[model samples]
Target: MEMVRELASKKAAVIFTKSSCCMCHSIKALFYELGASPTVHELDQDANGREIEWALRSLGCNPAVPAVFIGGQFVGSAKDVISLHLDGSLKQMLINAKAIWF
Candidate 1:
């Protein structure tokens, strides 16, 4: 949990993901399209992946991977991110977090 907190706060935007997940890739692409650079942690490649996933579960994230955090706040999962984007609020969220200039 400490590590999750640290990573979340370390960047304006962070994404906890698994390398081969298509939804994870889509989320990354979305952020890129929005001109926001998010710090991505590929759990599949990390030694503490299971522990981090466990921590995320404790935080109420189901399926854990592709969890998005903005400004140290757990924003949501891939579906939530897509919903926010479609609703036109994701850009503002990124701006608020200072993750994007615009």
Candidate 2:
């Protein structure tokens, strides 16, 4: 969890993912399309991947991979992100975090 906190806060927007996950790819694309550069951590490719995955699960991320943090806060998974986008809040969050500019 500490490592998650450290890594998540390293940038305005962060996404913990696995290289092969399609959902992860979509979410990353969403951020990019919105003009936000997010810090992406590919757990499956990291040395502490397994442990970090455990921490994400413990933090309530179920299947985990696409865990997202915005403004250094644990926001949620792909569904949540899509919901936020539909409601027009995701863009606001990106702006607030300075991950995107108006």
Candidate 3:
């Protein structure tokens, strides 16, 4: 949990992902399309992968991978992000976090 928190806080936009996860890819693409240069942590490629997955689960990320943190705050998974996008709030959040210039 501490490690996750520390990593999340290091960037304005952070995404915890798994290489083979399609939803993770989609979420990353979404951020890229929005012009936010997010820090991506691939759980499958990390030594503490399993532990971080467990920690993210504790943080309310049920599936763990694709967990997003914006401005050091948990913003949830793909569905949550897509919802935010649909509601036109995701861009505002990114702007507020200074993740995207516009």
Candidate 4:
């Protein structure tokens, strides 16, 4: 409902990750466990991944694997995501994404 509406109103959420990146997989797994499936933009596969890497770097963030964004807001890397979950803030984020939680 509200979360789905908010996600639909946004442009897109991109996740920059590589195949061997453990943090990338962890974030994806966490999202799955939370029931919020995000659109991943794998930097290792997309031809424009380099450009995305550049964009993230320009934002004063290191071009690291598992970078995330929702509604164009930078959400940081996998450790950041885990911290959000551990701190109980991830629920709000999932709510905004219209995710059906367990």
lDDT of candidate model 3 versus the reference = 0.97
Candidate 1 per-residue C-alpha lDDT over 1-102 given as tens digits, one digit per residue, 9 for 90 to 100: 999999999999999999999999999999999999999999999999999999999998898989999999999999999999999999999999999995
Estimate, for each residue in 31-81, the C-alpha lDDT of model 3 and write its tens digit.
999999999999999999999999999998988889999999999999999
Question: After superposing candidate 1, which stretches have Cα over 4 Å from the reference?
Answer: none
TM-scores for all candidates: the values are 0.97, 0.98, 0.98, 0.76
Which prediction has more favorable TM-score, 1 or 4? 1
RMSD of 1: 0.7
- Compared with the true structure, model 3 gives a TM-score of 0.98
Mark the regions of model 3 whose C-alpha exceeds 4 Å error after superposition.
none
User: Candidate 4, residues 1-102: lDDT per residue as tens digits?
Assistant: 233233324734446677778888888788767767677767788786676666666655564678776555677777777798899987677676555444
Which numbered prediction scores highest in lDDT against the true structure? 3
How well does candidate 1 match the true structure in TM-score terms? 0.97
Q: Could you give me the TM-score of model 2 versus the true structure? A: 0.98
Weakest 10 consecutive residues, lDDT, candidate 3? 57-66
Q: What lDDT would each prediction earn against the true structure?
A: 0.95, 0.95, 0.97, 0.67
Any idea how many clashes model 1 has? 0
Model 4 / residue 40 / CA error / Å: 0.6
